[model samples]
Target: MNLPPMIAALRHHKAAVTLIALQVALTCAIVCNAIFLIASHAQRLHVSSGIEDDALVWARSSGLRRGDGADARARADLDALRHLPGVTAVAQVNTLPLMGNDWSADLGVTAGDAQPAVNGAALFLGTPSFLGTLGVRLVEGRDFHADEYVDYSPFDDTPAPPTAIVTRQLAAHLWPGQPALGQRVYIGAGSSQGALVVGVVADVARSAISGGTSDHDVLLLPVRTVAGPYALRVDPTHRDEVLRTLPAALIAQDADRIVTDREAFVDTVHRYFHDDRAMVWLLVTVVGSLLLVTALGILGLSSYWVHQRRRHIGVRRALGATRRSILTYFLAENMLVVGLGLAIGTCVAMWLNHWLGERYEVPRLPLSWLGIGALLLWAIGLVAVFGPARRAAAQPPMWVIRQ
Candidate 1:
């Protein structure tokens, strides 16, 4: 029951005690970080994409109907769909934002003295009506007009395309010193189809959730020049009805073309992170298992100590000590071991973070995690020691006298 005597007893079993301590420390460190990472990812996933994610239905249709009349056939199908019941504004785009099928290209801006630099990633491209369909806000420059899509007059004799509208972030990234208006930026090869910066957009969010960055220097062009999937927004209440009738609608206009199937916007975004999220859950499971193992180790060691010290415990019980006193003694010893483990675990957790930061995208261990981890280990120690404490209290004083 004495402190020094109990400490000496632990020293006699140094190897086993160290093993139990190490397990507790490692479990605390690993579990703490795993919980934080999962929380961070969940936070990212919950962020609003700034656009109506629900009340929207999207589908992908590709390949030519015999490759002979693909354009005419696909166009007819799209038009028919636009007229279908519950169908809202329908436009064809290369890719939908947040769906992760973004077409990124470098912009070469031509300033009088500022050389063209391929610096930022633009996360959008679409037809004139693409903006309206996706509900994107145009802050500065005008949207792509029909003439801009078909005209080659300015670029016929020149090397650059005549116009382009970019996001505010893109504007700042390219020309931080001055306005991006009227600035010429080259998009594709030979700088032949030059895009002029006619307007600046507030900022376009490509997905339902963003990772704290709204910086995009998007170059919106006529869909005629690009090749990709198109999105059509549908009312959520009518999603099932739309899905059931979409194929028939397209078939009514162009029976030979494929209408594909309808998909919810939420489903599309979820698919993007399905794999990453699954892996995070798997990591949490593994850490949970390790913590269980550490608890068992502590319990086993505590039980062993009570069994080995039956005579000592009996002597204490016989000397006017209550059952509660004997129970408290073992529990306090376990707490001390857990406290020591946590102290040592702090450095070990930091070492793990150093490796994690270098190899993975996870940030370094924050100070709060360390404190929380220590407290958690203390709780585990109390829980694990409880079993042995109860057993020690159950034994009668005469039991050790007989031994």
Candidate 2:
């Protein structure tokens, strides 16, 4: 029960104790960092797609087969659905944003006196109403006028082409608010095509959760007749009826083609993040497993110590040390070991965070976790040491004399 004796015992087994402490420290550090990283990814995965995804239903009827007459059937199907009940808005596009496949290319801008150099990339191709249908905000300039999207290439020797809308980020990068409406910007490189700056829009958004960047550099053009694979916005309450009627309407128009349906676009976006969103949950499982193993290891170690210290406990009891004193002595030793592990773990965790910050904008650990981690360590130490303390307290005076 004496402090000096207990300290001497710990020092005698310093190598073993240090090894166990290091193992515990490493486990804590890895578990905590994993938890934080998982949380950050989860937050990003749940971020809004910034569109009216809930009401929108998307169906892609691509003319994948070479020289197939399916394009005609698909276009006719789109027309049939347009007249379906509860269908609010329907549009066909060559490519839809966030549906996994995309058509993206590099673009360049030729400001007043600056020679055109390629500096931006955008999702090119869309009609004038694509912006409005997709619910994108116009920050400056104007959305494409119906005629601008339809206008042919100007015959004049002007360096820039007819018209297009650019995102705010692109605008700042190119002109920096020098009235982009009348300014001309050339898209593509080498033989870059000219598209007049008709509007400056707010930042483009990801089509779904897994999209890498905003649709910031989009150049939308209007078409008199769009091709197949249409997206429709329908009232949620009437979705079942719409889905039922959509196929029947298509069949009535063309018996050779089949129309497929899926839930609203929002649900599809949610599915994209399914794995990433579960990261936090996965981390919780891993941390829980590590803690369980650590607890069991401590318990086994404490049981072994109780057996080795039987005579010591009996002698202490014979010398008039109360059962409470014996228990407290063992508990204190366990806590001291846990405290050492926690200190080392905290330093390692800070270094890991520094490494993470170099690559990502992860937030620093709050001071509150320090106190909470300390409490958890203490609890674990106590639980692990409890069996040994109990065994020591049960030792008899006769056992002391015999030993």
Candidate 3:
């Protein structure tokens, strides 16, 4: 329990102690940031698309050739899929969540303003039944009526419809603390022509998952486009059977067009976030490895010190130092080294986090993680040194003195 003697003993082995402390410091810094990265990736992978992922399937088709009537063919294709066994709902959609292809537009509160209110928002152009097909619930206002649905084409010169429904997230961004329903939001920058926000849906994610607040930023327009992707909702129990036969059914309706990229909504999400999942596991592996190496460093140094100071320990035991005292001395010494490392590592962790935040837009690391990391490393140090400390304590004073 005495301080001066332990301090003097540590001073004699300053180089080894400093090396171990530095190892612990690096471990703390890297592990903390790695954990943050892993958590971020996991959050991204688990983000809600706000759709009935298991019950839905999506497929893309090339537009009809010159001889084929694209609109008529598309309608027939949808009708055929709708009649398929176990298919409940179908809608022509421009984009689906986590597809990586996004239709975005800048929103402005005032018409003809050079600056817009929100720079980027996911735009979904579909029929009145689009929300129903995706199973997105309406939190406020009502769905678009059949009369409000407009036939529009992306390849044509027609502008976007004047009526729109928005996600709750977009509504909040456009009009904070106010009812988003019955409000008008300008569509294009510097254009007074805007769409009235007729409805607010619970939540719908964008096509691309950016892992930001904008993930749920969506603007839905009741504009029917025949030449786009199609989403179908099927009975969950019959999803696999429906998925297999649905493609042939669509193609049967339109032999001229190709039904490509058919996939379940859940599968699409998984494929989209594949890299994110991999990154999470990779960072977890790195954290585990770093902690293992740090523990090994502490164990190696403690064992070496015990071996080198066996005679010194025997003399202290002869001078009435109890086994518990010897063990406590070793543990206390390891704690002092670990504490110094933790102090330095905390600063290093913050600095590293700041750099990552600036470069990668990651959020600042929380102080709680620092505390957790420090505690984890402290426990590791104690456990790593315990074996050596026990060996030192069990050394017979007379046997070592005679040797």
Candidate 4:
């Protein structure tokens, strides 16, 4: 298409053109980054905790005081919960996924106060039914034998757990190519307390997301003690019923216990990711609002330009510029304007990502998203100008003579 006339017209309207171009530039830059952030939030929300979250529920209490009576009450409470309708498995647990980061320890291969081979693996001390209730699949080896499960005690003389189950990520981190099963690893970076790797599970998330592979590096020890919050596996359909009524039942069953908090495991996951969900919606709103404003700006400018240049368009039609050519002219003009904005915006987007990365450690927005954003803006600009372009092209030859 011919460019000289369009260039001359743009020069005559330099201030308006510059203003709209700047708007497009900012929109392009923001949209790219906003989309990238939305995607990041989405990924975080969907990251697997590797537990059967849907079938689980946990109830915390002012119960489970440490003593034989407390232990008997805890066991009785477990029995009461298990016999309740729809409960498939039950265990007393210190930590649960999306619950909180209650404890973490490092494990060393050499086993004598040497530097830990794996850092920040969350420790789980649950009953014999812990794996069954948590619903983590064993990828290799076996669950702790019934005899292997021990009562949890702060004063136990055992140096370390006799057996442990590890996540696949943790296994790979410590042993690399070697099998993690049957490998003896130290419990802490400072102690020679040794534990045997009897089982390897696919994944079980740490109590908290640490934004690293350490989030998957969990160590499960078989400690058969009833205390603290209890993890229950039930029919998914029955989870709500269990969550709602179990607390009341448990409270009524014993005078020593009082149910403090009750929640479905899936609901806990949602609550844990509440900030990510909010950010996703916020970015979506910002992107939607900016695109709406940009489209309206293009539409308004094209309509006004058509009105001001009426005589010029009629004269062009009289001089034999075809209707198709007139439409193409307006469309091409908008493309050129938006293309300039996109070029400027690409640089701005990169700079914005760099700035964000430095301050927030946000990942760089990919080049592909930049290209996609440019194409989207190009299409929007063409669509916005189409109606005014058609009106300018539709005037009859006699209309020019009358004017």
Q: On a 0 to 100 scale, what is the lDDT of residue 37 in model 2?
A: 67
Expressed as tens digits, the lDDT of each residue in 1-403 for candidate 2 is 4668778988977765786588678766766676666766776665654457666676643232224654465456667777878887676555444555544444555423234443435443544466665666787877766665552222224343367777666666667656667666665454355677778776654333233344444555554334435667677777667766665675676565555544567777777667776776788788788778888877877777777777778887888988888889888888777778888887887787777767875567665555555577568778978986887787786775576
Q: Pick the candidate with the highest TM-score.
A: 3
Better of 3 and 4 by TM-score: 3
Q: lDDT: which candidate is best?
A: 3
Best-first order by lDDT: 3, 4, 1, 2
Tell me how far the alpha carbon of residue 257 in candidate 3 is from the true structure, in angstroms, after superposition: 2.4
What's each prediction's clash count?
Answer: 12, 3, 0, 0
lDDT of 2: 0.64
Candidate order by TM-score, decreasing, is 3, 4, 1, 2
lDDT of 3: 0.85
Show pairs that collide, candidate 4: none
Q: Which stretches of candidate 4 lie over 4 Å from their true place?
A: 66-70, 151-158, 210-214, 252-254, 397-403
lDDT of 4 by residue, 1-403 (tens): 8799899998887876887789899999999999989988888888787999899999988766777677677777888899888899999888897776556777888868668888767888888788989898998999988887776543355556678888898899989999999898777766666789998999788888845667788888887674568889999989888988788767766766778888998999989999999999999999999999999999998898777777888888888999999899989988989888999998999999999999999887899999988898888889999999998888885685466
TM-score of each: 0.75, 0.68, 0.93, 0.88
Q: Candidate 3, which ten residues in sequence have the lowest lDDT sum?
A: 62-71
Model 1 stretches with alpha carbons more than 4 Å out: 1-6, 64-77, 106-120, 137-225, 248-261, 317-328, 390-403
